[model samples]
Target chain A: MKINRREFVKRMSAGAAVTALAGCMSNAGRPAAGRVVVIGAGYAGATAAKYIRLWAPDIDVTLVERDAEFISCPLSNLVLGGSKTIRDMTVGYGGLAKYGVKLMRDDAVAVDPVKREVRLASGASLQYDRLVVAPGVDVQYDTLPGLASADAQSKVLHAWKAGAQTVALRKQLETMRDGGVYAVHIPKAPYRCPPGPYERACQVAHYFKTAKPKSKVLILDANEDVVSKKGLFMAAWNGPYKGIVEYRPNSELEDVDASTLTAKLQFGSVNADVLNVIPPQRAGNIALVTGLITANNRWCGVNWQTMESIKVPGVHVLGDATLSAQLMPKSGHMANQHAKVCAAAIIAMIKHEPVNQEPMMVNTCYSFIDDKNVVHVASVHAYDASEKTMLPIKGAGGLSDKANELEGTYALSWAKNIWADMLG
Target chain B: MAVAVGCPLNAHAQDANSIRGMAATCANCHGTEGRSAGTVPGLAGVDKTQIVQQMQDFKTGKRASTIMQQLARGFTDAQIEQIAAWFSAQKK
Candidate 1:
């Protein structure tokens, strides 16, 4: 316990040593703090990693990210519409280094929770006092036929993850004939980004309006009605792009035929020049491999106060991977909010301080109907001691009155601020 | 950490971190610790009275906003005072 700070730094791993030195400088009299290994550098994990170091500089934070750059899923639809490029949504992880978070550019292939370690694909192991898993979502192709193979998936792009496929899908629309039908199949509810599919429709339709007037944007939704920002999206579809966009609800997908570019629905089949099928989704692969999917074997359950896994000790799950509370949506903004709360809890836990009994989080999601006009859904969730969960505050959140250029500006500004908040 | 500067002696130290967590929800649009990076106005170093009053106006429809009107109504009066103080204490 009386070991010198320099000795401790030399004894620790490269990743932990630098942070330990920083901690020693800032926290002169304190002991070297515990280690926190966070998996997936999306909105949640990146924010968590940064905030943990910001608040409690003594703790060693190592962030594991497979991708060299972070491509945002929000505003990715603009790339599909040709309004923005993939570079606009991509950012580097170098910002995290400034906060003393060691960036481990490797995949966390396995978790040994009992031994309190994570095994990376590079044959390296990370031991942690706490593990944060924010693996976003994994789109399951096996649930749908003709989409299980790589060739079929290549032909019918999901573009849901917002990277290369986003650009490829844009290419498909650009090359499609003037009058060709570009159909997008929406999966059932509880998918990532509830209003994403509809916003995507508007984006594609906007492209169709300018480039190919006769081209149609078809929305085949499995849900009975619009899932989020219903009135706002309806107004856009009816008022602006009335002739261009078509909506068919309750059109459940039985299978897909990539060769014919047809979506085989339970009722019938519809052929299209470009078929974008957003298949059913579950928690990411790491969540699956770690056996943390507790809800319907799809989402992990967590203690709302700390986001610690209900099934496993010392492991916390965040963002879309967790079973959402009553009113929470799987949006990046909400994920960022979740990261702050998790970071605060982890810091307090490390310091043996009392975790906040009352926690409040807010979600503000903006969807661009076109490039300039946007609609949004906002809500606030407060921790309820009685229910032991976060409950949406009544009358505090709602949809935008309508789509407008002002909110569209706020949408981009929001993206810039949030990205800076997480990555920087 | 700047939140501790202006905190009254009567304020519970633990409650400071609690308010910090609550105030961070605003950082998605506002910048970290309310130092905005984009079109949204930064909240850092603003007067507590001004911040609280604006939040009250937004909540009561006295101020018009693209999204703040809806977000302001979420916080109770007491919570707004604490959050305002935290942001007010931060450097611009």
Candidate 2:
């Protein structure tokens, strides 16, 4: 942001004029103070926690995550297909302790909304003046007739939650035969990273393009097409792994006849040496059992402006768990954006200041097609008057149907810079 | 009666510019103090009051945003607090 050019000088002059026009009466008082407890540590939760720590130092901040190490779902597909490793993607919370955060490594068994206390599995309760929950998304394996659970994940690899399953899936991919058909079974809607399955196909195809050219991939997407950059990924599929990648859409996978080592689909039963099943998903089980979600067990509805739970008072849900009419697809980027907006409203409440009932949101989703090939879709929008949301600025940013040198270079540069932006 | 344009960049930049200067990118999209006017999100207003909690999410990779994840890495706990304190000081 160093503006040294003549253009910069002109802008600075204009900035001075703007400043003079509005007398410099800015934030003149101490910021309101209170302790905030953040649960979960995924994109929305973690981003909210990090920004909270950076922005408010005096307010004692406590972060509770069930796990010690964090592995991301964003680049996780890369690991499954073998473009990246768990070591490369794993993260630690040691840094948060230095920033005045009390980091607790324990499962939050129950959130007592009435008492404003969270009871942990360790039998300890922590009270918070304000609470933030960004637990990310939870997979509803039970929805599927025969799907893998925490106990059965090892037998069949989902590789969706990160950690051991990621390792297991990679191992399975390595052991598959050169000419074997690797089937990737993608579920229906309301899952994390809709573009994820295609990205995994691209990364794996990148591997099979060189290592096992004869090996084939069968993608069973239960949709019309794999979302975002569908055209680009398909073009790559045709160019590099023409015979290797086979994409099948609107083909829903039914019960897995594991005895046959094949997925039973509506079209037909397809056999494979490896089965990568992305079971249907919903909000975390806690969100469902605790009455945070509707009977559908999909998501909880919230006031777009408040992010307050429709069912309860003083309860806010962000990230993939809460249902928003903003039409924001479930992604970490959207969750992070929503978390900040919600946090701002909460802060206004603490300060006893006039809270803006109307707030806008920003979202940008990027998928790494490979080390070089990536696709991004960005939008800038606010909620409409009906309390529903739409893009105010339509088509601010989206993927280019045809890739050029500049788009490729920017996508690569963006990957590097975004990592810097999020966790550098 | 003056408002800071951005976070104090020079406060502790001797160690790692990447770590300390991370939130600045957000300020570009978000506001300088993160009190953005609905264009994107006001990072300072809410998350900061919780302090290092959100940063902890970024640190652990529990949160994954290509931008914020890179921004959160390679920092000590003390630096996380310093930046949170600095931004929380601004107007909501």
Candidate 3:
């Protein structure tokens, strides 16, 4: 019973067209129809909103975001390294409008899952049949000492969100002396991007090696070692960046003197011309307010099958906000994968079709070791029915053999292709 | 010959959405509907057998790539065949 590819597509298209026409007719007759409201216009939310509109045009989909433009955090380190600019990374939401997704330029202050309403900062409330929340992560600055005051915190930039703070940190780096020390403090596991701080270290080191050869990059890591692509990162640090980058493991940042650009470690303190304090993070603030942080009160927990909150029905969590199964990296690519699985499930639920039981996702993360050398880690994950979680499919993916100039070229091409897929 | 190679994929038409969902992940790098907008080769309209053979080669490390080798190993033979069929059916 084999079906040819052409026959399959033809049948599927015919079925879809007929179903969609019926859905449109029904939607036109009903004044109040199915509406899905997505919070946060990020990798996950944007993809979910667009796909929902593309798959189920009868459903009213609205994407609520805090900013007018989306700034990618994936390649933001290049901005700090002077290889890219904020403008180059920022994209407007106008492109999503073509998919019939309404863009709401406002912050989602509160979510009433039981009431099926989201209250916005602009004194407006949106009702939803289903809600997709992808608010990313919120850094806890209060956990770090000497960063309680707005004035003090201004000097120590995280730049993890990839917007104003990114520009500020880049500017600070530009103003530093040729031989100055640039310090970066990384929090423990489950931060936004697993390989981000290491990649940042590499990018900054590359900058110093070329533009400020005498300067140095000091990486203060709380983790035991580089969490992702450790071998590759270690090779880069010991090889091309031997003299420029200094990596210290188990050096958790206890406090900071932003005024003096001094990091207070358990053993001692180190002063730098510029400091980047990326504090411990949890799910976005809205998730906390909505009681979605069911796992250790740090991240939202959802069923791996549908990405729907285990505690709240009809509410889904995606991207960095969710406590995914072990071995899942909190990455943009994973978020995009979550969006597709979630979108498919939501569409099926609305149309009374059987949701796909076996969902497979793939993630590939690239790290720029230098301006021309890049390394990567990739894996495929599949839902385990018995385990009730997504686990890596062994033998399907691994780290790059080594960082190389060709990977660097692929890294750029990857960024361009992904951004177009998400926004174009 | 190409059409014959794609026959096995048609049996799983009931899982069309799942197949499409998995294939969509490739678009992040391959381009929308596999019509690459960059230097990465577009998969749309490529021969199913060619796509399947290349993926198998990548999985086996016969074809060296910065990322594809690792990515190719993510799927089983059947899944790879289905993905190849999906893209091969797309317009060039």
Candidate 4:
């Protein structure tokens, strides 16, 4: 952002000349009015990029994503349930074009905070007045030594990222015999989507109910109990899938015997027809490599009001990569909210306007117990100026009373709306 | 000597942007600017009073809801009014 006046003027496009010139009047050293570079095209980054441009048409936004299309991890569990497909979850970046966001199909290999630049794998460097990084999570294969090898990873799928792995896991289920056992190991807390593993168990169970009734669904949870929508998930497991679904708490996986299809625990090992090992996770590799992570060496700490990285100025972190605030789940919905707050704040900062002081965010996560029944957990968070972080509003958010078919209809609509909100 | 080309946003513009931020949060389930893609009801161009009343009903549990009852409690009455007004201004 610290560029010579001539260089700044030269870089500004013809359409942006007016704003760029206006920016130069107040301060000789100020960055050109609106040059933002956003990395990752997931819920957070895509929304941030699009909203920034939508709100301020003059602002220049360049979104760098390694993948050509966005594969939503939100409804990916449905693919395993045989209710949805990978094609259903996939969305293209083509929508962003109408909003004037420049799309770069390349990996963000490194970020230079000092230089205010992002270096892509294509050997191109993007200079930015501000940087937004929403890299999501990095599934740590290293944490599970047994699953570190490529062969082991292929045999014991994670399917946490919601693309190829999701389809691969579904294929495995399709191939399993009618009486086969499918076991999934849940990692410790502070990972993306606490309710996700439980939902997956339901989806797999639903698939088994109609497709392979004799099949068993085993959940080996590392935590002492279910992490999210616990009561609702418990009701589903005990009610509809009583004999088919088995829940084991505090079953921390020691390692995996991929070849033997065994999950090694502290006391014993459980063998299954298929094993899914969701390894421990941390902030995505880009966040880690760029030294954006400040909390427990896992997540990037941020100023909640602006979503700006506390550790690095001129760089904002969003979505699952961030150290979530109190009661904030790392969800696509929450990330979309983060993107808006961050977008509004960044726009204000560039315009030298007062940022929104009392920002609020809400999270609503729905989980489908079966193909027809769904439940949800909701929370409302507002900034507490005194505390310097967002706190869940007392008596504001709560869980659903019960799982019902009505919620299932709403859940799908919610997905469609949110996808359009971020991509459309 | 400095040249003033694209001037900074005025106070009115800033206020408008701030409210837009709050309203945009609802877009996750409601649709961008309240234009829903399907099933869920759209909020754009609705009467401000109607929107406020509906939010109040959800907050008070007078209107049965699967999720709104929980989400509506998150916003203050004043914030709800602002969001309602913003959505009322959006094109249907």
Candidate 5:
């Protein structure tokens, strides 16, 4: 059970020995003191991975991600407005490597906690003393028939996965016929970004107003009104893109005929020259398969302070995968923040340390309604031990009842500062 | 420049001293040991690698943090190891 440091170091450089040691590390978890394996390289996973390495460099750390570069969805909408490109949103993982983290460019397919192993699509198994799962959100395209995620490439572009999907969607918008109709479908609640579809609509309308005057945008929102960042969205859509943007609230898109470029809606069909669909989403399929989500359509349930799965031990869920009634729509910013909360818990457990009795969590979501203005929603969290819930600080940080130039300016500054805090 | 004498993180119990010093600095705004005064943050219980990496990022300019970079730039490799050691061992 004793692994000499020299032997461990010797084994680490050699690939076969690394794997062997990794296996041995899994089986030798006598008292939960060793390497921690983090799956998913999104805000959640990346946040967890970096924290583990920072807290315990002596303990081995490995990050598993399918993509080499991460394109942030936060500032991505500006890409559609011609102010930014996907390249502007892209980030490298070299920061993690510099911290001595092992990067595995492979998809994690499954995990067996009993065996303390994470099986990847590459047929490699990663051993962990403690496992942190931060895979982020997964779209359930099947929620809407004839309009799956694959539809992004052929007819309607979701462009939510970043990389090629984002670029393809941009190209689709770029080559779209001038003065032609462009459409966006807002899915049901708890999607990746609450104000994303609307911000996207505004960005498109910005393009159309300048490039294609005759073109109009039709936004079919499944909800009664804009969800997150409501004031800012209404201000932009109503003030800036007012006449050009046709917003249909509480009207869901029932069907899509990609060939003819038409969307059938509860209200009526809207024919379009180009279509962008943000489909209904839930926790990642990996979470669903692992029973992290419930039949109530909520993601994993957990003790708000610890973020440990109420149903499973040695497994913690963060990001869009958990049901935190305290927070607003799931955003990468929130996910990253939540991952830190969970990380704090994990580090404590390794040394048999007592956790803080009351936990405080925070998250902010920024929406770029237009070039001149951006708005943000923020909140402070308090974990209630009795209720097993994380509640907001009532008057702390929420959207403005009336967004003005001052609010907009503050939001812009807040975003710049927050991004610096999270990804900076 | 000579190292700050009477620095809270003295030679005795280097690990705890470094951890408390790091936490105290962050707590100036983030609250004690990573907890915040509502606006800043609570670093009491966060990812260890992420915290250290973020500090590293701020120090190297990979990420932007005026105060954090200033704070991070002051730490040496041994300090970082000690800081990570103390904070990661904290409970949420």
Candidate 6:
């Protein structure tokens, strides 16, 4: 259905304003006012905090993040391939301050939904009129038997967060002996970035081909097939990096012996010089701690329109931590899009206006097959009224024709533009 | 001239604000307020009909693009018109 802004506001304002007013009166005997505290300043939280201040200057917005700098996961695979550096992918929070978002470098340990309070590790408590949590995803190392130990985890680097681990993994790749086996274990579906493990495989293969000529890259994927951009990834796997990259599907990792650098799969074990295990993941720990996670779900259940927590009022969840519908991959672009929708809805609710019933979001993910070749998958999702979920627009999105150098250039440009959109 | 039943000549300020909210997504590539700095053309001050026509072309296969083709198809015709109007109204 077509959603015109004027028509949508006209239709929704009457009913929405009444509901919001009633909620406000019951809670505070007044309109929703005061500060908004956003936790975890990743793409979602940072964008939400920035937009709240930009759209509604009167309302105070505070962004709480443990790290002072932001490291991007989008182009991070380039780091593993020696194409990009961590410094190139790193951004500071100083740009966010220009948007009037207060930046707090502190860990938020606990959140009290009823009190609308967030307690920090620094022993400071913050009260909020609205709260947005974009904690991303947390890797569940405990699910893998031998990976729970610190020594094992240190050896089996996920490097999913795009920081020190990325560098360490890169170093491991660089130091591998010629003809050494570099094994990568991919978890099952619903993981962050569907094509990410494949991209990692390609990147490492590219590195092995160029730097360590005889070194081989082995991919042990739990899923039966490539999760995304399957055609393009398969073409590249068989074309340029053939024989150098070997893929084994349905190889669910059961255990890891870090001392021997061996990953025991459901059927057999694979020994490698460097083991990169992308472990099973769930919502950020804070979601479970704050009771935002719904029953039988590892992620937080949120209203797609407003991103408000299904179980808790005055709290919203975004990014990978949210159990989003419409096959929304847990990618940075989707997180940024989710932030915009949540930001708009929060602003409308605060002003006693109707939140837009139909919100449109776009996700464009690019994967580098090599230093010069890249492939992408793009989709546009809109709120489906009858289904009550976000669904991809039919015939609106698809994968790139094939991996190409031009798309690689576009991929880099896309990263530069999106980073500027979020931080600059 | 008779006014259309659903189309208002002068929309509310809030309506424009909401339109801007949706249009902000375009700003990622189109540039802030549709004032582009790169090779991608700016939509600011462009004719609404021209913008709408190009978007329609992209949505269809008539006008090929590396990414715009997929992105344009996401919106309905009505949303496209609104986006066109929003960008056309902006200063160049």
Find the candidate with the highest DockQ and give its number: 4
Per-residue lDDT tens digits for candidate 6, residues B5-83, read 4224222434766687778777655665676654556778999999999999998879977778998988889989999
Model 1 per-residue lDDT tens digits across residues A1-424: 7879887776775656566555423332345498999999999999999999988898999999999999999999999887999999999999888999999999999999999999999999999999999999999887787888899999999998989999999999999999999999999989999999999999999999989999999999999999888889889889889999999999989999999999999998999999999998999999999989999878999899999999998999999999999999999999998899999988877766668888899999999998899998999999999999999999898888989999989999999999999998
> Each model's DockQ?
0.47, 0.03, 0.41, 0.52, 0.05, 0.30
Q: What is the TM-score of chain A alone in each candidate?
A: 0.93, 0.86, 0.92, 0.93, 0.87, 0.92
- lDDT for every model? 0.91, 0.65, 0.87, 0.91, 0.67, 0.85
Q: Candidate 2, residues B1-92: lDDT per residue as tens digits?
A: 11135223212221232222334435434554565533344656465547688778866768744344434553457756766766776568
Candidate 6: lDDT of A341?
A: 87
How big is the positional error of residue B46 in model 5, measured in Å on the Cα after superposition? 22
Per-residue error (Å), model 4, residue A357: 1.6
For residues A73-130, what per-residue lDDT tens digits would candidate 4 score against the true structure? Answer: 9989999999889999898889989999999999999999999999999999999999
What is the Cα-based TM-score of model 5?
0.75
State the weakest 10-residue window (summed lDDT) of model 5 chain A. Answer: A23-32
Each candidate structure's TM-score, on Cα atoms with residue i matched to residue i, is: 0.93, 0.74, 0.91, 0.93, 0.75, 0.90
Question: Which residue pairs clash within candidate 3?
Answer: A3-B10, A396-B73
Q: lDDT tens string, model 3, A137-158?
A: 9988776869989888789989
Report the lDDT of model 5 for residue B65.
38
Question: Candidate 3 at residue A324, lDDT?
Answer: 72
Clash list (residue pairs), candidate 4: A21-B5, A22-B5, A22-B6
Off by over 4 Å in 3: A1-33, B1-14
Native contacts retained by candidate 5 = 0.00
DockQ of model 4 vs. true complex: 0.52
Local lDDT at A219 for model 6: 92
Docking category for candidate 5?
incorrect
- lDDT of each residue in A83-128, candidate 5, tens digit only: 7788877777776776577888998898887887888999999888
Docking class of 2: incorrect
Fnat values, one per model, are 0.76, 0.00, 0.68, 0.77, 0.00, 0.30
Candidate 6, lDDT over the whole model: 0.85
Runs in model 5 lying further than 4 Å from the true structure: A1-32, A148-153, A295-298, A400-424, B1-92
